[model samples]
Target: MDLNWVPAADRPDLVAEPVRPALRDDVRVAEIDPALADTAEFCERYGMPLDTSANCVIVAAKRGGEVRYAACMVLATSRADVNGVVRRHLEARKASFAPMDQATSLTGMEYGGITPLGLPAGWPILVDAAVIERSEVVVGSGLRRSKLLLPGKALAELPGAEVLPLAQ
Candidate 1:
């Protein structure tokens, strides 16, 4: 799909208040096949030397026979260390990655194309602090074959995202 045809406001609602700058001026957006959204392939295809890209992962924790959804935003440079940081913060005995089947089914986003922008409500987004410093970074566009490049700070403010010192 050509994002150029979609007006900024008409774009899918992000989790955060819609505060996008003119995307073309501050960052770049690329539309590639869904296959390229995979971490290894995205980096290789884009010739990105670093993995500072934001990885949107869905996590599930059982809350009294019900499951809660959360979004984990880790720097591709590091891991979420869910057991160490995320679980502790959530006060849960265990926090696990949602199965690919469940995540895709719930988020309506392809497995590799999940971006923090359009996650389900009540899903807390945890962001690694280091990502805040990057002038520009690539992240999923709620669809396969498309990626958004923009100032890191703009991403940090996405709805429900809590910028925390969660990275190594």
Candidate 2:
């Protein structure tokens, strides 16, 4: 009931300039205990429904000695279709979650706080269609000690984002 969301503008590095303005006016940011940053913990501690929380995971795949990176967003109720839909879409033979080192370093976000917003350009974002239907969803704030909440449709409109049935 109390998400404690403040203005997202206060967190500059955590939110990219381009991505921030594109988000809706109702989007909010809030400080959270780093320990509760993960989906289950955050939902349990904050009294938010698990179904309304989304996980944005970075994935890696290789093809012909070249590596491709992608971010897949799925609701906590479901897992990302990594090896199936994601692999096929990336056109890679095998796809798996990116290492913590790579994911955090590339996105400039904490391991447990990576969000779909502020991802490196050229990286494709595959959002589960179901996740976009929620009126409000809680995601990471680029820091384990904070979280961001916004309309699910706002994420659907991000640059290079594809709203697909990407969860199983």
Candidate 3:
């Protein structure tokens, strides 16, 4: 994709505040048009395939008057099994996408740019098996104006991350 990849740690401004401390040496960041931050537009504009992009979706799960939030990482071409696999995995009676305001505020990241890297402590990060098998993948940098590129294995190594067949 011809991106000028730079160490994410060296470009703190390119990532969200919470993401800064989680940045690993293997992660790279590249600037992009904020308008193209969405998966479809970003991949098409960069001539990248859908399989090379990953999306991190925030899910809100509830059980016995308690709500737990999780981040699900799925390939751009796949859909997260939120109602099925996720609900069961989280042991929550109900699971749904987190509201934009809550997601952004809790993650300390922009709505469309939330990434699993810097999620709050104790939040389960369910990573689709397909995503972790890839050698490299593009993901949000916690900011709409840039993107993060790293080996798929890196995602699986994040704190609270769990590799699972969570995509359908």
Global lDDT of each model? 0.68, 0.85, 0.94
Looking at model 2, the pairs that clash are none
Instruction: For candidate 1, write residues 9-94 as lDDT tens digits.
Output: 44434312222332334445555657677877777766775555778788886655777778877778788867778777766778
Which prediction has more favorable TM-score, 2 or 3? Answer: 3
lDDT of 3 by residue, 117-165 (tens): 8899999999999999999999998999899999999999999999999
lDDT of 2 by residue, 13-70 (tens): 4453434644456778887778888999999998888998999999998888889999
The order of the candidates by lDDT, greatest first, is 3, 2, 1
TM-score of 3: 0.97
Single out the weakest 10-residue window by summed lDDT for candidate 1.
Answer: 14-23
Distance (Å) between predicted and true CA of 114, model 1?
0.3
Q: Per-residue error at 135 for model 3, in Å?
A: 0.4
Q: Say which candidate scores most in TM-score.
A: 3
Q: How many Å off is the CA of 74 in candidate 3?
A: 0.3
Global fold similarity of model 1 (TM-score): 0.79
Ranking by TM-score: 3, 2, 1
| Model 2 spans with C-alpha error above 4 angstroms | 10-24
